[model samples]
Target: MPLDGQLSTLNRVYKDKDAQDVLEHALNNFGDMALVSSFGAESVVLLHMAAQINPDVPVLFIDTEMLFAETLEYQRDVAAQLGLTDVRAIRAKRETLFEKDNENLLHLHDTDACCALRKTEPLQRALQGFDGWVSGRKRVQGGDRQALEYFEIERPLGRLPRAKVNPLAHWDRDDLQDYIKAHNLPRHPLVAKGYPSVGCSPCTTKVKTGEDARAGRWRDQSKTECGIHFGANGAVRAS
Candidate 1:
């Protein structure tokens, strides 16, 4: 289906409820769907929701290997706490990394290439076999994602045509925090240390008081996205 058609379908079906309701409905309708979570600040809410509705729902975690130890620990802890049975940690192939950039200087000289190798490619491989995948992205994050929709037609993986569901696309940071608190969910420890958005340890840092939530990521660069969510033609759909 065309992207516009997919978006229209989602908007029509999920227009009545908030983003969370849309997410729950997606999981309920598509039994084989998976949620791709970074286990960042407010990730606990979605993880908890999925576990409550279906503990068996697959939760794909892209462990870039360069991520902070805290993130890995939190991923395991949160999954265990929520009783999420299908959490899979995806990683870049060692051979691919060695062959493409022997010095591992990809992120230093060319961040786009580095993200492709470490994040995009691995996630593409991990998403295979699923009819659709869910993301924790929200529109309020702004930048290239300000106009994000609830659903998008992602590139097909293997022989399967896949959909990317952004259930929280229209939510703001405050909503995320409220959900987490209302549910009494655990938070990523670094969030209290001023890191609103977390990514690879080498590229992430703590943000200032009034800085954008995403400012901590790729601090020295102008890059906002890692390119996996963009079209093959390099156009970024909102969220």
Candidate 2:
């Protein structure tokens, strides 16, 4: 199918129901589709939803080699409980890391470069051969993503452009919590410790009262995202 036709079909399906149904429909239509997960707070909801519909759908888990131990544990636990069959762990290339940025302090001086090496580069590689992928992003997450759409085109591996689906784009924080609670899904351990938004160990912190959930990630920095899902012209996608 042409990319435009695919986009139109996805948009029509996504407009028909809530996030979970859209996700299931996407997986049903595109058998090769996968879900990209960070396994952070509230991540299990989507993971469980995907598992319920199709346990064999590939679940791409990016292990940046800098995530919290609790996050890793939660990832494994959720995958097992949900019976997800294809939980592929994507990782950065050691040679690229050593040769490109030997100091390992690239994030401090150049976060974009560091993310390109650690997060974006690996994810781009993992997305190879996929027709499309799903993300847990919601509009309420704030930042430039405040006006997110259910479906958009993405350049897989940051090169070969393809359709990208955000099934939970319309869901809010309360909706997520309710889904998890109703399903009795396991929560990320750090959430109870006040870290509403979990990312890498070094970059994430606990959120303060009245602050946005994602404020803790890359605190005090101008950084909003790791730059993986942007356009070729360097425009960030709507959250």
Which prediction has the highest TM-score against the true structure?
2
Model 2: residues with Cα > 4 Å off, grouped in runs: 156-158, 235-239
lDDT of 2 by residue, 1-239 (tens): 87757877778766768887788777877647879999989789889888889899999998888899999999999899999999999988889878987776777787677778888878878887887899888889877677777888775443656777888888888898889889988889999999998998988889989998988988888788877776546635223
After best superposition, candidate 1 residue 37: deviation in angstroms? 0.7
| Number of the top-ranking candidate, with lDDT as the measure | 2
Backbone clashes in each candidate structure, one number apiece? 1, 3
Per-residue alpha-carbon lDDT of candidate 1 for residues 83-129, written as tens digits (9 for 90 to 100): 99988888899999899887867788887788888888898888777
Clashes of 2: 3
TM-score of 2: 0.92
> How much is 100 displaced in model 1, in angstroms?
1.9
The pairs that clash in candidate 2 are 124-157, 145-238, 145-239
User: Positional deviation of 236 in candidate 1, in angstroms?
Assistant: 4.6
lDDT of 2 at 24: 74
- Please provide the root mean square deviation of candidate 2 (C-alpha atoms, Å): 2.0
Residue 36, model 2: Cα distance from true site in angstroms: 0.5
